[model samples]
Target: MYFIGELEGSSPDLKISLYKWNAKFFVKFETADLEQVYKISEMDVSEAEVRAMVTEEFIQKIIQRFKEMYEDLGELMGDY
Candidate 1:
């Protein structure tokens, strides 16, 4: 497993790591305190190529969803 790169200034502290096993690329996204993994079968592309597919816009979308979930949970907890 090799750490390809990371995105800075992300809302939930996102980091990307790549692991190659049996000629398969495993793209791991560490967002906030959660770990999400995506498998990519393309092994002939550069690290930048993988990063391009996982764009900042996509990450922002996930972050927005997470924020909304947390906000809703907080409200529910307050009512308890």
Candidate 2:
């Protein structure tokens, strides 16, 4: 994967990064222990458009997914 750049406006605790690999672009949203990635075909959108896609609402959805993932982990760890 080739590092593109990081996105701004993500929650302080969350990190958002952009990458390109295999003719695709990857948008990665990560918290300390959880992460979500979105893949887009390079032909589908340009890098600038990809950045534009990460709107505030999208970040909220990513945050929610992280919460769900953490909850699932907690269940698997017996609520540890």
Candidate 3:
């Protein structure tokens, strides 16, 4: 995968990166030790469109999902 660039207006706490691999583009959001990746087909979306999709509301939802993921991981760790 080739690292493209980052989306504007993304949360500072989250590292948002664009990557290209074959016919797909990957948007990766990272905070601390956790990450979420979204796949988009090059045929379906342009890089500009992908960057435009990362609005403030979208970022808020991503942050919420990350919080939920951390909680889920905490629960799993409790089993050990």
lDDT of 2 at 24: 100
Model 1 has an lDDT value of: 0.66
The sequence of per-residue lDDT tens digits that candidate 1 reaches over residues 1-80 is: 65544544344466666676666677776666456677776667665677677777877776686577678878988999
The TM-score values for the models, in the order shown, are 0.54, 0.92, 0.93
Worst 10 residues of 1 by lDDT: 3-12
> Would you list the C-alpha lDDT of every candidate in the order shown?
0.66, 0.91, 0.91
Runs with alpha carbons beyond 4 Å of true place in candidate 3: 10-12
Pairs with steric clashes in candidate 2? none
The residue pairs found clashing in candidate 3 are: none
**How accurate locally is residue 32 in candidate 2, as Cα lDDT from 0 to 100?**
86
Residue 7 displacement (Å), model 1: 5.6
Candidate 1 residue 80 Cα shift, in angstroms, is 14
Candidate 1 vs candidate 2, TM-score winner: 2
Q: Sorted by lDDT, highest first, which candidate order results?
A: 2, 3, 1
What local lDDT score does residue 28 receive in model 3, on the 0 to 100 scale? 93
lDDT of model 3 at residue 9? 60
